[model samples]
Target: MRLWQRTMIRLARSRTITDFMHASRLMRPFSSRFVGGGDAGQAVATAQELAGEGIAASLFYLGEYVDSEKLVRENVDALLKAIPAMAAAGLPLHVSVDPTQIGSVLSWSLCRENAFRLARAVAEVARGGSHPARPALMLDMEDAGVNRETLQLYFTLRENDLPAAVTIQSYLHRSLDDLRDLAAEGAFVRLVKGAFAESPAIAHTVRSARNASFKAAVDVLFSQRARERGVYPALGTHDHRMIDYAGMVAQANGWRRQDWEIEMLYGVRPGYQRRLVQQGFRVRLYLPFGRSWWPYSIRRVGETPRNLAFVLRSMAGAAG
Candidate 1:
């Protein structure tokens, strides 16, 4: 990572920076530009709006690192409510969640119970025909620290017959292996270039290498073995090059647009998303909502230097 990106990542994780940004009215507009809203109702409404534009959405309630059961329960409750709301709105939606946000950091048992509850709720919602497409319950991958536990939880969900999905970071060296294993299980997977700052020891620290890994991983996901086994892949990227490459790969493999999906953040590359949809590609927007958007917003800004203007405005607001 570049020095500026590394610095921004550290700041993104800092509570001091989070407080400053959250308090700055100047940041609200930028936040709303990316974040869906502050609650489930607003998020579902946003999803409905996107659906009207022929875009599917993956709704994420943005909070993580829960150290309390109360917070975990609250997260589950919100998801339970959101599932039905998205269905009622007739929006094509996938629900993404952080395991730690629901109690994975507290205890494995707590996390397991909470995950099962949310998955069961989603299953029930699907059965009711509220979400006819049977939108998946996806577990958003965190840093390397929780990788094993997150994967365990995902497989456990599948073992119990829950239609679950897990994310794999292409930057991580272990991701290739994880992809292979997930493919063997016919599990749904989302491939991202990774967002967290990490040591070069475990993750690809170079941009070119990471991009290469991403394409290689995509190839593995769409390999004949994986496809025949019914392993679905979701390509999460906004890079035009990567997007075009994915389309080329699909075409070469004679895969239909519905066989795989291109996932992008809700606010990033809107025009590209529209163009992809117009070209008969399946696209899903990652829509994050909730009051705990500070950390998430900071991470988004950290990932793209172009977003630094919002941070500068926030800092200026604080100084003034």
Candidate 2:
């Protein structure tokens, strides 16, 4: 990571900054730009609007790194309870699951049970939705630490005949091998250029290398053999270069736009997302909602210097 990003990350973790962000209402516009809303009801409303534009949604209830049993249950139950209503909207949808937030970091069995319950709920409701591509309960890949366990949870869900999907961080050196293995299983893989910071030894710390890794990942995920196995690749990126590269590869491999998907963040690059939809590509926005919004909002700013500058300028305007 660059010094500025490292510095911002450290700042994001501090008590003063966290508390300020949590309490300030000035972040409302910025939050709405990227976040779904402060609760599930509002999130569904946002998803409905996106649906009218020919896009879909993957709803994420944001609360990560839970430290207590009560918090874990709260996080799990919140999403579990929201599933049926979210499905009722008749939109192509997914509930994003972060294992660490639901006990993977502390207890494996507990996390598995929580995840299984959520995935099973999705499996039941997905059949009733109108969209042909079955909605999946997506397991988000957090840091490198818990990736294996997340993938295991996904397999367990699948083995039991539940609807499940998993994410792959292309920035990781081990991702190509992981993608190869997942392809054989016909796994639903959401591919991203990873957001977490890691050692340069294990992750591509620079953008060029990470971008290359991402393209290379697309080739593996969209390969003829993988497609034959019914592997579904959701390209989770906003980069035009990556999008174009994936489009080219998909066309060359004789895949239609509807066969795969382009996943973008709810608030980022709205114009580009619509353009892709108009071009007949299936697009889904990752929509996060909940009271625990500070952690997510700060990371978006830190992800790019331009985003950081924009937020800072917004803050200045708010102060004025």
Candidate 3:
């Protein structure tokens, strides 16, 4: 990572600063840019609104690696509660949960239980035909340290015939192999440039290198036989060049629009997202909400230096 990105990542990781930003209204304008709301209600409402606009929604309850079983239960309950509204609104449910946030901080058994509990809930909602078109549970990949656990949970759920997906961070040296493994299991994969800061040994320290890794990962995602398992590779970057490249690569391979999906954050580049949808591409907007928005907002800024500067300026403007 560049020195500035490293600094931003450190700042974003600080709980003290995150708390301060959340407590003050001065950051609302900035936060509002990336976060749908500060609660579940607003998130669903936003998703409903997006549905009206012909865009798909993916709900992510804002939280991080959780240590307590009680907290994990609460998170699962909250997700279940969000489902009714999502279903009622006629929105296809795309449930995303962080295993670390659920039980990573606890023992391995606890983590497995927590993940299984989440899978059960997803299966329940999925049973009612509430979202027949495409209903899935996404296992949000965190730092590379938890790669083994994430892959294990994915395999465990897959073995049980659960409707599941796994996110792979291209920046990690091990992700290519992970992608190949998940492909054989017919798992939906979200290819992200990765958000966490890592050492050069395991991840690229430069933006260009990371982007290159992401492009290569996409090649792997689409190279699989779509006729057999149907690859649902979600490109999670806002870079127009990468987006254009995705279109070209898909076309060259004779893949249709539904073969892959474009995933973007809730509030980033709405116009561009719309244009993609307008062009007949499947676009899923990741609508994140809840009282845990602070950390998420910080991570958004930390992902790109330009986003951080824009947020800082917006916060200052809001204060003024």
Candidate with maximal lDDT: 2
TM-scores for candidates 1 onward, in order = 0.93, 0.95, 0.93
Candidate with more favorable, higher lDDT: 1 or 2? 2
Ranked by TM-score from best down, the candidates are: 2, 1, 3
lDDT of each: 0.84, 0.85, 0.78
- Candidate 1's residue-wise lDDT over 77-107, tens digit each? 8887898888788875479999888898889
What residue pairs are clashing in model 2?
Answer: none
Off by over 4 Å in 1: 130-134, 310-320
lDDT of 3 by residue, 178-283 (tens): 8878766567888888877788899886878888888888777776364256667888888888888877777777777887788999888899989888888888
Positional deviation of residue 289's Cα in model 2 after best superposition, in angstroms: 0.5
**TM-score of candidate 1 against the unseen true structure:** 0.93
Return the candidate ranking by lDDT, descending: 2, 1, 3
Candidate 1 Cα lDDT to native: 0.84
**TM-score quality measure for candidate 3:** 0.93
Ten contiguous residues minimizing lDDT sum, candidate 2: 126-135
Best of the two (2, 3) by TM-score:
2
